[model samples]
Target: MERKLVLQRVVIVISIISLLFGSSPVFAELNTDQLRATFEDNSILFSNNSEDTNCSPNAAQRAGDAAGELVGEDNLKKAFNYFISKGAPKFVAAAIVGNLYQESKGNPILRQNKGSEPNPLKAGGKYHPWNPSKPAGMGDAWGIAQWDPGVAVLYWQQQAGVQGDVTSLEVQLAIVWWQLQNLAPTSRKNVLAEMTASGNVNEATSIMVKKFFGAGIPRTDIRAAYANKAMSWEPDPSIAAAAASGAATNCSDDSGGGGGTISEGGLNEEQAKKFMMNYGENKNNESQKAMGGYLWNNCNGGGSNCVSFSVFFLNKFTSTKGVYTPGNGEAVVSYLRSNRRVPTGKTPKVGAIFSWNGGRYGHTGVVLGIHGDTVIVGQASCSGPGKGRGDGTQSGGGSGFIRVGKINETKAWLGRLPDEFAYPEVDMSAVANYVGASTGGGGGNVAL
Candidate 1:
């Protein structure tokens, strides 16, 4: 009886150990044969485009001509071959080609309109001739993939070493690959692995559309059809075989720890709201000495006072002590990046530090809230209406009053605070006294 009891006790301990350290379940690789069969079954659901209509007699030549009109047949083939050479599956390359076709019909130099310049990176204003001397950011998208010429031009120049004209097919393709490899390496790896495993043009196209294109257009059916068309365009057999054999080589590793995960532990929503409300009330107090200058110091200019404001917020709310405060807005971005605090995407959340490149000093703000496409921010700057909380677009001018602004008109990067930081309980009577002492005249009265 004693031996049986001991045996039962040992079995329970072993079961508990297994539960604690068992391996996670692994998903099976998709079967290529099944994917092909499914695609064949769904062929009738695909759109009947020009490629489908002219599939006879000189089918190969006609298909080549169609691709040529967009980016030239040779360039299209080159992009496919390049992807395969880099160990990406042929299906993955085909998926990208499908998206490119939809974006510009394969034309590398295509602009939003017929006569506009290929480079859209110009100063924010009316579209005009390419000055080459002034800053870019004028019009809509341009290039083979219809990229925002303003932003795309900078990346192409700096990353790819492409100079002079920014409309070259080769340069655009390079930028595309660069973005996939760098911007979201984990997503890229997953897409590549899935495409290689399945060898399904349609599924690969869908993944690229969602992950790479940011869902710019809602034409998944059309994109799937295009991917099928691209797959029919044959590539060199040797390149395809090499790509298949080297499937283990990912274009890039997730060394930066997948860009999507925000650092854990910070102010929760309720705590953030409480802090902002207090901060806003303090901001409206004209008698407060900090209102006249940046963070209680009299430093007025066209430059932004965001760094000072951000530092004050961090010092007051979190347990962080003696935080380095840079006056320049761009410098603040550098500081956050150095600390590994930059968030992954442009989407704004409450408590995010928003940064943008605006002239010499740039601009920075703390996100108050995000509603649909607009982000509400608290900031100090020369461009918006002077001082006091507004939406994201308000200007701070020379006086260093806290202001709120609306930020859907421009692009901004975000930096998140370390997760371990949280709001601490502090006395609020000082803030109430500051507001009560205000003469009701000095604070900037910028309205939304």
Candidate 2:
């Protein structure tokens, strides 16, 4: 009993510490049980929502829940807003609430290792910080959704799969969203349809148990109660759309990964910085998908090359859109010059839309930072990581599937670089915000 109490205190302390760390993993603070649950790589992106938007935490605290007192306001709000942002209806979000509460009591970092139920968490000692650096043995379930069969780690942690704590509330929820939308086998995907079919919270709860969990239904009543409580926070329509369309970027602070917006037409330094910082932070698969939807709907950017990518950024972060002509990437530069939307420059500046006319199709990338000789640029192609290829192509140069590549970033310098860069009057950053050490798959410290 004393040990349980001690762990509970530890849980509270960790929660406060996590808040202080802001989107960074506090895995080193974990006891074995906690550490066992973590495995991460930034293959997909989901912004943090440590603070619930549109609604405040319900004051009716459920103190004895998972992770002890830390479960109530923080985790619940984070989980609900996260699912909702991914276009889940309230009940769909609520259903996830029902299932997760039953699975791990809303704890994003909960771990239960290879053991039959009744006495889960047998792998309590299996979490040696070094273990996650390798493949997890079969049967361990980790994180909020309880991703099972330790092998799931292979999928969860892509490039960094060998190691890391990708278990921020957003990352865990992104895992759930990724599973439901793309990764889950057919049966699990059906739950997304079924849950969205009706607002019947109880029915949705049952559906999650049978369809998503693939287990005998248990604790439907308690799970339903949690689901009901989750629905308490009314969501905002615009924010939901933005969350569904684009990955979160707090253009204002970049304090930690969470939902921050550019407020549409308020484009300038914030717009360029948001683009640069977010790409630096992640620029992963789902980041492409979520942001791809925005790129498509707004700028007609569903193509397979540089033109589509640059146009998407322009139509999105800039005030208005014009000249979304279809063709090789260089044509975009000509159109911009003809329209006089941006001034041409030889030296690359942070937030400049660079145009390379050397290649047949030409190429384009957005400048994020300047490290003296090298300009850190975010680019996309049906061929690179800044997000040009895969299924994320739909129309002229605007929207679709979502793929990112380029094994390593392509580097360029001032004198010869792209020859031309286009940016409104926005000076994203005169100096490097990515100086010393950094975190995130995209690198350095920036907002969520």
Candidate 3:
């Protein structure tokens, strides 16, 4: 009788759980206002009323021509004309706008959903946040030019001096225009220089044009456009004047730690010892401060701070003090290349160091879990997650898997975790903090 009673209770509990978790959700989808706001974050504008064929097919070429009407043309032209007043060439300005349009779909105000599908790293499965129904991806890559989150934020801060909720598409759009006006360069010589440096000027220019439109426009046509506007178009002498003249500024939370923040949950024995040692000697006994300093000075910047967070973590985990010998970043990269083992796609267990962009440090993230080609990872602030790059948002942080183990030259290395690390024992706080914290919270916690 007791067994039957227990069984009945179990059934009731199961039924309740099903009812609570199974269907008929109560949360509502975003309304139009929210949708508009989201789109507003990732969009841009440009035009081509110029005689130069290069400037002809600006944002208006594809966006306006397709819609059979002008889209952000007046605003774009005004901004272009303003650049001209500032000595920017009209042709050069059009070319700049063309680049933006190709990159950003010419919306000038759209949101990039960081949680959106086809995760760039190609992580399998969609991101399942606590609120499953919440929107995925962060926001669209806004403007006529599609700048990533980091670049976008840099442009915004440099130009508009605006910072706020990164998720707000409206703010992102404003930043987009501000970036075009103030942060973007307008030197025809510089443009030509960049084209020439790419090995094939025609090919490079063609790529730019293709990026703007769906193709069919030839390089010759694009060059003609450029030529028409080249001389007639004035140069914007102060294209980047805003950034140069602005106060000391920082964009994209720049904490060397990934995402916008750092979490110091995982520490091997040696790492813990080093943390204690650093704190034991520092004037400020705060572990957080020490960790933050370490990230900024040693591990976060381009060259000096280029050591992989995990490499530093391992050195500290092993109680190795000051593994960060002063030298070019190449030495550290070489060390990782030599010491780290590779993970075959078929069997990528946890604790693997993954390199991207052909070992160029184009981007790096730690593999938290692996299943087939899909990999779950924790990425740092390699780029911005929303429209306005530096706007503090957790979208830039936290744990998400990507499918990168499948690619070649993309190698993974296995590291020794402390004996204390059991399944579910790995300290993912850094990973979590990276994927969850905003730019303001960029504290390097692994070393701590």
Candidate 4:
């Protein structure tokens, strides 16, 4: 009799759960929104007017054109890379993300609601899509930028070419780009430069909040917090791109890092992370400070030099500190050729040291791993893009070590195609996931 009673109670509990969370009488389909809110953070962009937004495609759109929807940190990296590809400085990219995070926490497919918390990251009570005929009042806002009155969608719709997939980030961002460059009001045009050119990330965030997003209720502090976090994620300075190209103000393909796993050159992702925890980020600890001093004495840029950090990482990870290496990044390839007899080549391999020896110091970095066309590189330089031709280091307080991030594989990267990649002097020939060279040059060359 007791078991029977327990079964009845369990059935009742499940019925109640169904009423609240399941697709029962109360909600015809809550699961779809739930999946979208939780897993659909990247309904994403990349439409060639997808039959969508009418803005002329720029590098930002073209670079990310092949990417698909992703959530969390993945989305963050995509956004950062997208802006950097467009030649926006780190600050400009951060400002854009700051504004987006404020609006949708970086969710590309966000809709508005009339609830107390109108912009919740989850769909929840805020799943109201835009409807022009029945505006649905304040709850009818749409897009990552959240154009208001819900009726704003109508204006975008009327534009000749922007007709499909209203929720695509490609569509929305393209439209925003089009409006700013083409249709921005006089006030926006006046302040856009102030927002883009500000050296300080905070100042840029403030101007963006006031002039660009044009928020009815000001939240610069919160937006700036997100912006600052984005800034910290960068591997070099925004100005680093300027050094790479004749132009010193736009975006450049930066060598960046994030966490990755590989079993090559007697190194793994966790060990790479250990290197970062010990040497990278804004830890500002005594060890980091001391290492910075040591780097300054050796690499000549006070701990922020790429050669300094890459050499240090290779030696440490290979468990051979104070070992074979050159003074500047420019000599890394030759050093490998002469000393190690390992020829550097075009293809990137996990656990290889990549050198872009064209500029002054000729930037050098560790290839933590590779995913698709993106290469995760670790180097100490600026906090944005590496100055390809004139590649050098930034002074105090700028990000010097990037043990985890990613960069696109292009000749434009590191000023040109990597002169060559040097494998660490550890046994990786028979490792489970060991990667070999892809080039035709035969004999002793393990990986190029």
Candidate 5:
């Protein structure tokens, strides 16, 4: 009886200990398992919601669902709004979202050695450089929507005040908007409309899949997989007609009255100026760096200082204007005169180029809001390392900016390179036509 009592006590003690300690994976909660499950379920849900007759739940829906899970509905809406505000055609955005759905199913996966899963991280070690096969993990590619590191870097640098890591989910949504703005249209709304007008969802899906993915994946499978899911998207009414008309669908001039408008091709004179103001506020600079960063990063291919910013902005605004290569100074000048002309002093509009050196090339920047004598300029630059290294006006050897024809508190002498430099008169209509041809692939048409 004494031995039995001892055994029973020992058993009770062990039971108590077991109850107190549970064993499981330490990081299960953060591993994103719950999100994965929810994503799978939503794919089926969306597939069933398609209005098109031929729409059926399949691989496309699965792909879209996976992609959707990465972005979520709320983020998706925000991304759509961003592109819409930037003058992206609704259909083009739809197509891009669809393409992303197909590629990696919204997972940020890049192939290194060859196309394979469970790839190791390239940047797992401190000295590692980026490689497609090996993922950097977490901050490398963090959501359903995926973007290149260069783009992610740019997004974080530009968007200020929003606290949190760029790898976080919320930041991914904002970056998605930026990604959509970058893509050139593969298909326009008219093409999709024409296909759908004949009442063939399968046909439309097949064509889009082929264009983006090529023969890598079978068309039938891609169409069936996404048929039902893709049909559920309802194009925003404001952009539906324009999309159908085969308008260039990407970041363009904003349509607000006070500032310039951006078309799908890029910003108009008014819109370009507004972009500067927005860029300035985001960069948190009260002086030339803001302008410099815009000019240099936009123009030159180097750092995000004044010179490169201008180069990038102008290149974006005028797609025909070649990039500022090391020996292409003369070429850049010729393009500016023949293809890209700026506004006159009388007009003094935003985005006008203040040329000097007898049209041999002086400097350029988007004119921010003009207030009396102070002409706000977004000068691009090639800043060196330091706190205020690349701010626009700290000129010597590095690229910078200066206001011509006037000097004040906001404006300073641009060293007076010359008095009356020639300004080219580029045809806006021709530029628009060039944009239409370059994007949307030859014939301009798309479908959602």
Candidate 6:
């Protein structure tokens, strides 16, 4: 009888502790288990006060419940808005939230707590420093996605100082978007396409879990259920569409009245900069390396060839038909002058191709940005680290790879796409803001 009384007291003390610190993993795990059970039974985890049991909860209602239990609703809303504002479909945003829910219970600062062992599987070690020069190893995972050391290092390197604190929801969300944009463009694009086509929350969540998170967790059913739960909370698609429309209008207004509208294929300075930066950053990417190699090998037929690389970016990003020629620098200038030229004396616009005299072929590169006298250009066949052929051979000058640099050594001729051409159907403002913030300034030269 005495031992039985002691056990009851101990149980009461433990229950009190659990209530006091609801964020404890012990409590979190317990709550998840109960939630899982509720899901399995097809019972509602939450309910309206009304008698309509059959009426499913909408996104706002579900979001409120999640806020009470996990991260605040405001943070989740910020993430959703960011994704939507950047052109992601609502379903895809919801899928990301679902993955975050499983990875860290929506806790941005949550770290892996496996144990006090040195091994990542065992947990409890110093978090890896955010450095990309070193290989990422199994270190204590941190932040919203529980990003392993390796992935975290790469992300940190890319964003550099913009990601002030890894634990902050703002930075974490930004990093997530950046990764989708740069590191996994193909997967991200495919997922967005699928979500747009199907508009199915379940399917989007499942695919995101498999591709985005690599099916990291074993509790696939629970994750899917959570994704469904998040779906009910997503902002209306019509609302986001309206916002995007308004943004486009604002962009047109801001670009002055006569330079042509974004919808009409006119490339603005910001849009052009964003495109050039992405190209420079991802030039050596697996998807782009072959094209880079082909352009290097075949575009000039082993002669001094830099014009093809510039033309490649122009054709890829703009609504213009890039000149296809194995021409010298003067030839490229002549081609631009004769075909849709923006005139020679006007200030060089962002996204304009700048041709400079070099040896026999001269040099050509895409004008990324022009800050006063400093003209930043993204060029191929330049000399620098990671800037040449995919096979480590130099093609034109320097390292012979795609790279960005500030040019002061050579006089340049400028050419722009026609003002009547429509810009790419993307939110250029968002891209501009993201790139500017990530790189620490608007005109600073970045490698990629």
Clash number for candidate 3: 74
Model 3 ranges with Cα > 4 A deviation: 1-94, 97-204, 216-224, 231-235, 243-448
| Decreasing TM-score order of the candidates | 6, 2, 1, 4, 5, 3
| Cα error, candidate 4, residue 74 (Å) | 4.2
Better of 2 and 5 by lDDT: 2
lDDT over C-alpha atoms for residue 62 of model 5: 13
Model 3, range 1-448, lDDT digits (tens) per residue?
0112321221000110101111221112333344223223222111112222211122211111111112223434434433233222234335444443334433443434332221111211111122234223343343333343322332233224333433233334344333332233221111221221122323434534443222343344544354344334333444344322211111111111121111111222222223223322322423223234555333223111223333443343222234443223223323443443211122222443433333334444344433223333333333322211111112422111122233222332211211111011133344324333211112222211
193: Cα error in model 3, Å:
15
Q: Please provide, for model 2 over 245-267, each residue's C-alpha lDDT reduced to its tens digit, 9 standing for 90 to 100.
A: 32221112221111222111111
lDDT of every model, 2 decimals: 0.40, 0.42, 0.29, 0.43, 0.32, 0.40
lDDT by residue (tens digit), candidate 5, 333-384:
3445455443123223333343333233444444432322334454543333
Q: What TM-score number comes out for model 3?
A: 0.25
Preferred candidate (lDDT higher): 2 or 6 = 2
Q: Cα lDDT for residue 304, model 1?
A: 32
lDDT of 4 by residue, 1-448 (tens): 0112321221000110101223321211223233223222312111122222223233432322323332234554556555544445566667777877787665555566543222222233211123233222333455666665333432333221233344555555544444433333222432333444344668867877777667878688888898888877753344344322211111111121101212112223343333333454423453234334555444333445666666655554443245434657767756765775543444455556777766566777777544323454656663343222121122223334333333443432444567766655432223212223211112121111
What number of backbone clashes does candidate 2 have, counting pairs of residues 3 or more apart or in separate chains? 28
Error of 1 at 46 (Å): 43
- Against the true structure, whose lDDT is highest? 4
Q: Give the TM-score of candidate 5.
A: 0.28
For all candidates, what are the clash counts?
A: 27, 28, 74, 19, 58, 16
Q: Whose TM-score is higher: candidate 1's or candidate 5's? A: 1
User: TM-scores of the models, in the given order?
Assistant: 0.34, 0.34, 0.25, 0.34, 0.28, 0.37
* Candidate 1 residue spans exceeding 4 A from truth: 1-74, 122-138, 160-165, 184-199, 237-448
